[model samples]
Target: MEFGTTSRTSGKPGPRRERSPGGSDYAVLSRQVQEAGLLRRRPVRGVVLLVVTAAMLAGSWWLFVAVGDSWWQLAVALPMAFAFTQCGFRGHEAGHRQTFHSKRLNNAAGLVFGNLFVGLGFGWWMNKHNRHHAHPNQVGRDPDIESGALVFDGDDAPGRTGAGAFVTRHQAGLFFPMLLLEGWNLHVASVRALRSRHTGAPAPAAVEALLLLVHAAAYFGALALVLSPLKALVFVLVQQGLFGLYLGASFAPNHKGMEMLSRDERLDFLRSQVLTSRNVRGGPATDFLLGGLNHQIEHHLFPSMPTSALPRAKPLVRAHCGDLGLPYTETGLIDSYRQALGHLHAAGAPLRAGG
Candidate 1:
């Protein structure tokens, strides 16, 4: 059997040329992966990561509180923000059922790590993220690409008017700065989702809301006890800003600047996942920083695969895509960001001209 051929299953040379909005090829890929036994959970690894991230968060918090001066506190808060980001990734994995075999355990962990500790609504995030994986970069379907401030596809371009025009014109330059508000935006969205009647289980939503309130109270109370009001405010801004920037920067390269399919455009699962996803070229440090998101193609294809297994899956996926004549994009982190920014600039050009 050739590297990318579907012959193993279908006795065919490769995937069919026809596109499938329902991701028909996904059934073939899933069968292959199941036979290869890549769907198993690594409970020990997940628990270890949880413990390490929790310790890091606790240590960073302690340092922040112990620092006598505001400047030193800010310095300590940087690590705290990074720790929070790691916890966020862990929560993401939990949401995907990648961390544990038991759905109940995974949900419990997601609630604690995502909702209580990180102040993100686990249920809300899962709902949004699952949609993203299902239809990445699809103009109308993928919420991640539907930002009002930043135009991705031509359909999202703003009409010439007001703040929309201003934002559309300067979105490329403002991308990084705008990300500084992403943390706050996520928290606000979480609260709104919890409050909305349409977000499913009222009991779970209320519990998540209560957890967020507790997180806010504990976070603000600790800051107030340890620092002056002004310093505390500054600390909050710096920490949340960094958290947002880090999170956004880490994720932006995955699909941004890649192909954008129309909502109605149909594509096989493999092509849809690979064409829109970009892999970061790096070593262990990159893996650690991106939380295995560097292998976005594989992650999208097999959302339930453990983070630790992503690297191992990469070569196989790349080879498969290669044989299928699919585009397999891999670039340095800095280069990927540059490409994303360039795409944004290009997308906004019409709005600027109209303005």
Candidate 2:
């Protein structure tokens, strides 16, 4: 949804004020959030969530193993995928050091939940995510907006030839289906990153690589034991496809279609985050489904703040943005997706024309 970018006083537009690109706006907001105690870690909440997610994972696996019918196993895959996504979210929180005060503990959790269980590379994800957070929608710098199957901007659109031209012409319509492959894409990317010298710490990356191997072995071995080869293949496709779709659906709305900053743009932290981030409008159900990511604006503003506390920080952040005449975009989930798709279609226009 659109939000005003002009100052309001007494229900009327005030004199326009220009903010310096690198002003102290973010610093002031950070101090306010810190003084209000929103930055404190919530270990108990983190522990409870961890325990509950583990139990759910165990239960789903048990159901998958115990059920003989392919249909029942397929049904079980739904919860299994959901549980896996939740574990991935936990890993995300740990990666941000929001789940634990101790860096070592957080790293341990990130490795276990992200690398071993979810098949994501913790170190690789951390480095990439940090860059995204540092430059949310920056054209050249933000890896999230970098050239991919679905280009985010016309300038980054693919060459007008072969699959690139075909996909760019239909990216908006193909976006959701493409997301079905995201799980596999992420797995390959993680493996490549771990193997690359640029990822740092060869020994640790090797250990993570081994753990991923173990996870794959256990995952396929369990499925093979429970079902025929064909069924096992189907199960893998269903589970991973759902996992990727859920992940992409939940994350795409956070920033897509809002704003695209130039590579050399110098924006204050507050303006950069609020303008780029879009919040999803919902309550508890949204929180559970999105892993409290519905409050994208707040999360972007305070990356280390616990997810549990994001909802509480939302109104405060919204009000502050309103007072400062900053953009605070929030929209329903379906509308957000539509906006994202629309943005993609518009971005691909130049490529389609060139072809």
Candidate 3:
């Protein structure tokens, strides 16, 4: 019945320990958090953020056009990338229903920010994200960790050959550079998902497709209209590349290198969320850059909780985890990335050995 008997002072997770699987621990903590009103929706704050992000996106475009057909336009693409990624963050919050009290309102915002503004599919992303939340880092369940260009699971590492093997063998070094293409990959994936949808596509899916088309038209049309051919091509490359890099950097630190669950491994809600998530310690700037995702443990514990409330919820969750002897991992931003990359490097070790 006693937890926390083991040491976790190093901030690295030790071997998995046997513990009770009852849900009462989480229920009690949830009730405590609810009493503190940490779970309440902060509509005004979310709306202000959404509005500011939209303004930023518009301003970036305005600068893009005003700067005219010059190499200096690449300078404008920098902020455009940041603005686009912020819009993606807003869509992420909406998908979690953290931005609005009403589910319909949240989905509406999600569709706009995700499909219309960011050219991402809200439905597809939400489905994938929800599965991740339900079973983060689980071998067969979490799509985020699924074997692909980068293998997170050791078992999936050895069989890769040719380009896949070369990439896998040096993934830790290649990770950030590879993120440059993530924006293009997301767009292609979203379009593919929409095209491959079953017959009698739902109204929402149809709406997503239309918004994406509009986004494509406006995004490409504006660049081509304002910039010369070479400039426009460079602008697209710069903006999309940095956008993906920004998003990937913000997200990579949260759960990578943390403990992963095998298919059959089980934990209660509290343990499953808190143990697998790593919080990055920083001030307001970090929160802004990461879109409040630095509080990963708290966010995972309360997915519906507003972004503004995650900081307030952090102490409460940490104390609760402390009381229960659970490992609450947190690190500096740079350190978090290091841990993640270290995991990738370790995962690819077997392939290196074979070569």
- Return the top candidate by TM-score: 3
Q: Please give, for residues 1-355, the per-residue lDDT of candidate 3 as tens digits.
A: 1243332222343544545556878887899899999989989999999999999999998898888889999899899999999999999999888988888899889888989998988777887788899998888999999998999987788899999999999999999999999999889888888766644322356788899999999999998888889889988999999999999999999999988877887777888898789999988898999999999999999999998889998888889888877878999999998999988998888899998
Candidate-wise lDDT, in order: 0.81, 0.82, 0.87
lDDT of 2 by residue, 19-115 (tens): 6456677777778888889999999888898889888888888888778647667788789889888888888899888999998888888888888
Q: What does the lDDT read for residue 232 in candidate 2? A: 88
Q: Which regions in candidate 2 have their CA more than 4 angstroms from the true location?
A: 1-22, 197-203
TM-score of every model versus the real structure? 0.91, 0.92, 0.94
Candidate 2 — what's its lDDT?
0.82
lDDT of 1 by residue, 1-355 (tens): 2245432111224433456457655676677677777778899999999899889888988888678546678887789889889989998899889988988889888888887788988888988898899999887899898866677865456554678778878888999999999999999889888766454432376688888899889888888888998888899999999999999999998988877776787777777788778999988899999988988988998999998888877777777677666668899999999989888887777787775
TM-score-better candidate, 1 vs 3: 3
Best-to-worst order by lDDT is 3, 2, 1
Candidate 1: pairs in clash: none
